[model samples]
Target: MKGLLVFFFIFILIGPIVADVPVREEQFIYSIMAFNGRDYSRTFCGENSDTIYLIADQDNFITTSKTLVYYWPITGDWKTDTRSLNYSFEGTLELTEKRRESRIIYPERYTFYNVKGEYEQNWKVAMGDEADKAWQHYQGLIDEYWQATYQYEQAKMAFDLMVDELAMKITEMRNDGIDVTGLVEKLKRLGPPESPKPPDDYIVPPMPVQSAFILNLPRGEYNICFINEDSAVMESSEKRVVVFEKRRADGIGFEVIPGDKWTRPVESKRSSSVLYVNGTTDLYLRPFFQDEYNDLYYQRMIRNDAKGNPSLMNWVYIQQVPGGRIEVTKNNHTSAILVEEPFYVEQTKGSALGYKIVPFDPEGAHKDRDPSLIAFKIPITRETSLIKFELLDNSGLNMAGSSRQVRVIIKSRWQPILLVLCLLPLLVMTVVRMIRSRKYSL
Candidate 1:
C-alpha cells in the first residue's frame, strides 16, 4: 500500500510535466493582425484555443493557415511552426454576431502604414487594388533608398578621405610656417555628405502575405468559422469572439524619453510617478493622450491566454498631444517654459562610450541625419532639486493630474553614506561579539 501511494503521488507530479511537453501537430490556425484600439498587433488562434478578444468599431484582420501548431507551456499560449509547413486555405469566414444572421466575408489584399508627424503616428489602412498600389510604392521607395544608400556610402568615404588629406595639409603648412586658415575655411565649406534618406514608411504592412479577411464590426459577441468554397463549414474552425470597448477615454500620460538612450525608454503609466534624472544628461518628456481599459480584457485581446487583473486598469497611448508647453517650477516658482522641439543624439567616436544630446535643426549639422526624437527638452543642472512639471493644453489651460515632480540625483554624493552604512553592520556585529565574549568571561 505504501509503494502504491508513492507511485500515485509521483504520477500526479510528473503527469502535468509530461503533458506540458506539447508535441507539434498539424492543425488549422487563424493568423490575425488585430487592432487593439491603439495599434495593430499580430496574434493567432489555433486548435488548442477556441476564442479571440478584440476591440470594437475597428478593422481587425484574420486569415487561415494550415501549419504545425503546438502549445508553449511556458507562456500558456499556442504557437505555430509556419516556416516548416504553412499552407493557406481558400475559403470564406462566416461571422455570426448577436441579433444578426451569419454573413460571409472574403479575403482581399490589405496594407497599412504610418505616414508622417514627428510626435504622432497617422496610421492608415488600404484594401484591394489600393493596398496593392501602396505596397508597390513602398517597395519601390525601399529599393530607391538602398540604391541611394550605396551612392551615399561612396560619397561619405570620399568626404572622409578629403578631410584626412586637409588635416595632413594643415599640419604640413604649420610645420613649414605657412598660414592655413584659408584652407580651414575651405574645409568647413566642404560639409559632410548628405546621408540617403529612407521613405516615411512607418509601415506595418502585411508580410509573407498581402491579403486577409478584414472584419470591422461593432461591440458585441461574435461567432466566427471558416466556410469552404462548397458552402460547408470547416471542422475545428468555429470560435467565440468577445468584442470589448474601452472603459475610460481621455486619460493622460507621458512618454518619458531619457537623454542618453532615446531608442530604449522606460515608460511609466502612473501619472503620479516622479521623474528622476541624473545630473549629466537632459531628458525629453513627451506628453501623450491615452485611454484607459480593463487590464484583463486588454491583455487577452493582445494575446490569447494572457493573464491580468480585472480590477486593474491599463492605459492605451492614443496620440501625442500636439502643441503643448511643459512648465518647470522649482520651490513653487515658475523657472522656465519648455516648448516642443526636435533633438538629435550623436554617439561618440570609436573606442569611446558616450552620447551628446543637442538641439536638432533640419537645416543644421544634422541635416544629413534624421531627428532622433521630438519632445520638450528638460535641461538639468547640478543645483536642480524637487522640480515640478505641469502640462498645459494648446489653449493654455493647465491639464489636471498631469503635474509631476522631477528629482535630480547625484549618485556619487551617496557614496560616503553608503560606505558608512555598509561598515555599520560589520561594526555592530564586532562590538556585539566582543561584548558577549567579555560577559561570558566575567
Candidate 2:
C-alpha cells in the first residue's frame, strides 16, 4: 500500500515534465509593399503544393468570399480572377477598449517581383495548388451556374463564355495533337510565373500587426492571458503590459503622465482592477518628435546589437518559456531558438515592403526606439486577457494588416497542488498501515 501510494505520488509529480509549445507565442510573417484589399495585409502563403506548410492550427484563417486580381506581366493587364478561391484569414487579435492597438500575429504575407511574363501553355496549372484546386473545384461548382435552365439564363451566358474559352483552348491543343503528357512535361521544364528561380527572386514579406490592449491588471499578481475575448474574467484577458522606462539618446528621462495624453485607468468592478479602453481611453499619446532622434536610430540600434548579424527592422515581443528560457521575435520575423535563457538570432522574411504602424503611447513606449516600431509581451500569471494588434507602414496612416484578439490565459502554480497530492497519499498510506498493523498485532 505504501509503495502504491509512492508510485501514485511519483506519477502525479512527473507526469507534466514535458512542456508544450507555446501556441500563443506562435507567429506568422507577411509583406506590405504591394498588397490587396484594404491595404491591411492578411493571408499567409497562398496554399500551394510547394510553399504551403500544414500547421497544427488554422483557426486564425477565415474564408471570405472575394475576387483577387493579380497582374500577369505577360498579359500586361490586371486579371480579375473570381472563385471560391480567394479566402482571407486574419491572424489573431487583442483589442483594448482604449482603441490603441498593436498586433500579435500579422494577418498577411505578401511578395512583390518584376515579372518578365514568359511561360508555356501549361503554366496556368503550375501557379499554385490552391489556385489549381480552387480552379478545378470552382469550375465544377460554377458549371452548375452555367448549366442552369429557365430564369437563370443571364448568369448561364456568363458561364457559357467561360466554357467556350476553355473549349477553345482544348480544341487548339487537340488540333495541334499536343501530346498532353509530353506537353505537360515540356511546360514543367519551362515552369510558371511564380516558379522558383534565381535573379528574379520571389519574396515572402513579413507580416506584423499593430495592436493594443487594455488589460484589467491588478497589482501584486502577474496575469497571463491566452487572449480571445471578454476581459471581465481575470483568466480571460489576453493583453499584457510591461512597465519600462524609455531612455532617449540624449539621456533625457521622461515618464508617461497618464491623462488626456492617455486614458485614465478604469477600475474593474469584477476584479477591482484597472482596464483601458481601445478608443475612449484618455491615454498618453505624444506624436513622433523628429528633432528628438535620428530617423535611422531604430534599425541602427538593432544592427549594432546584432553586430553584422543580419538583423532587420521589426517590432519584437519577448516571452519567457518554461524553464525560464526566453524567446524574442517579431511577428514578422521567423527564427526559433531553444538553447539558452535569452537567445538572439537573425532571420529574414519577404522584401522591404513598407507598413504604417502607430504606437499607442508614443511618449511612453515610442521614445527610445524608432517611433515606427513597438513591442510588448504578456507575463505569466493565473489570469487571461484579450489582445488585438494591427500593422501599418511608418506613416502610421493605413492599416497594412491586423490580427484578431488572441486570448492569453495564465496558469496557476502547480507546485502547491503537486505537494499536496504528494503528501496526502503518503499520509493516507501511513494511516492505513498503522490501522493494519494494529489488526495484525491483535
Best by lDDT: 1
Q: Give the per-residue lDDT digits (tens) of candidate 2, residues 401-434.
A: 2222223344458769888997998999999999
TM-score, cand. 1: 0.65
TM-score of each: 0.65, 0.16
Per-residue CA lDDT of model 1 for 1-442, tens digit only, reads: 9999999999999887875457889998888788876678888888777887888888888989889988788876778899988999898999998788988899988887766656455677878888877778878888899999999999999999999999999999989999999999998899888997877656454342277899887878899999987889888899998887887786678887777777777665666888777756677788888888878878877887677888988888888788889888885766788899888888887988988778897897888778888888877676877678888888888887678887887667668898899899899999999999999995
Q: Which stretches of candidate 2 lie over 4 Å from their true place?
A: 1-370, 374-417
Q: How far is candidate 1 from the true structure (C-alpha RMSD, Å)?
A: 12.0
